[model samples]
Target: MIGVLIVLCSLHTGFAVTHTGKGCVTGSTGVRDLPEFVAVLMLDEETGAYFDSKTRELQIRLEWALNKVNDSQKYIHYFNVLISSAIPDLMNALQFAMSLYGHSGGIHTLQIMLGCEVSEDRKAGEFMKFGYDAEDFISLDISTLAWIAHSPQAGIICADWNNHIETAQFWKGILENECFALLKKLVEYDREILERKVPPEVSLLRRDPSSPVTCLATGFFPEGIVVSWQKDGEDLHEDVELLETLSNEDGTFQTRSRLTVSPADVKEHNYTCVVDHSSLEKNIIKPVTEEEIKTNQDPENSLPVGIIIAVVLAVLLVAIAAFAC
Candidate 1:
């Protein structure tokens, strides 16, 4: 049987590795002169929200595997396994592990599960073909072939993220790619939710002084949703006031953003609290009830009748000149 590497994706919660500095033996590459097996594990940083009992079991299984491999000196003598954190990309983890071990050459495997609909394991056709043909590969999931066509290389194998390398492929060599992907997802999701008519029970609370609204909103998914206040359709400085949002029992969040805005400046100004959500995107414009009246105000919203006529005549003259030309 091929060597098995088990990867558990629950390390986003973080595991305390007892590094003895003596070097733990994982397994051998089975070579007489140089035998090294680089362990690479890919864990999603954003999946911290989905921790459950199943993931805990998987984590325990990984630790057991590591202990068993390290304890057995007869089959795999003097092999070393090191743990690396913050490796989100599959390929980058491979390169980094291989480099860290000072090995001349080795292949790093990854676990493949499409969190999205287009994950390589989604279909058996061009997507799978394109995914595998891209490189020397290993499929961590055994059930993938069940969904895909006949392929000899890619097979299901259980692996742990703590002490295992992955067979999955990522687009870049850095976790930043996934981070950016996540950011894009967040921004897009925010837009999507905020566009809804219900407005996601979200609202931006701006302060009159504009000192920066720093307050916690307690009431839905405090972390899942954004609570911010705005004026003139621009983001308020976060440093001016930081917000602490708290979630409610009903899974709603109430965010309080406290800011000290100049009451004189914004007394009757139309400042709006805009919320960009996944399903609701409506903004609640605060009523300018305090209404400011400038005694000597030069109206920018309207033009004098003589000025309008003069501007129209000038435009007409320009149009006629262009036509004549």
Candidate 2:
């Protein structure tokens, strides 16, 4: 017997330019620490609304979300009613999944992720997927409007759902039209904040003089930027690793590029970290010098002089770009 079970959908939101609305519903049983049922809503990867069985209420996470809606209270009430009506069906589905898995007890979860996105090119797409125990069980093919099963147990479920063609059509309409429209409206309501650009703070970091040099750029907006390492005015791709761009808590971005070279060789050659972004008039070029490398050995006073000047210039350039925009 399984002692407890919980399931939740995997959700990743988009950048500021491409607006989106993501929602997930979860059902669980015999979980002391978790709610029996929970639902969450996100706009552009930020929590816009939330609900749980304990509260039985649709609550807003962002204040501006309810401002532009024509019938604010009615809209809130509609979601409350919708989620309340959906809970029983969700519970039944959870039990059916548990039975299929042959789990009589323990913590188990069934999660559903559904969302819509409108890209910068105005191309729009939607998705709906189901998971059990944090693994994919089934997903909907928005292009064909059919369910695709990922596991043997989901085959029967998909077959049953596919028979109801009208229901699929109804959800398609809601996702593409209703959901897309609401996401676009939310972006419109916060255009100023969404469109604003903030420059990155660049730093050169290393564990010690013998360690690989790492160029860290953080707190930039729009998520579009380039980081490269150059040696003596030539591109140096070998022994250089450029990491993926990551999102910051404030809706900004951060990235890193590391260069591996012996300390003696680094001193002989001029290695520079080049950063390019829309917010800058010119690319930021910082040479890898011992004086400019922040070290963990003396973190408190290790602020590099080169990085300090680069940050000041970056702010001025970003200010100029903002004025031009």
TM-scores, all models, native as reference: 0.27, 0.67
| Predicted candidate 2 versus true structure: per-residue lDDT over 111-216, tens digit per residue | 7776778776364788877778778988878778898899998897788878877656766776777667766766667776567777888899999878888898
lDDT: which candidate is best? 2
RMSD of each: 24.9, 12.4
Whole-model Cα lDDT of every candidate shown, in order: 0.28, 0.67
- Clash count per candidate: 57, 12
| 10 residues in a row with least lDDT, candidate 1 | 303-312
- Range of the 10 consecutive residues with the lowest summed lDDT in candidate 2: 303-312
Question: Which candidate leads the pack in TM-score?
Answer: 2
lDDT (10s digit) by residue, model 1, range 151-256: 3322321222212323222211112233234323432433322122223443233333334333332333313445455656677654344444432333244555
Give me the runs in candidate 1 sitting further than 4 Å from their true place.
1-199, 203-211, 214-260, 276-278, 287-325
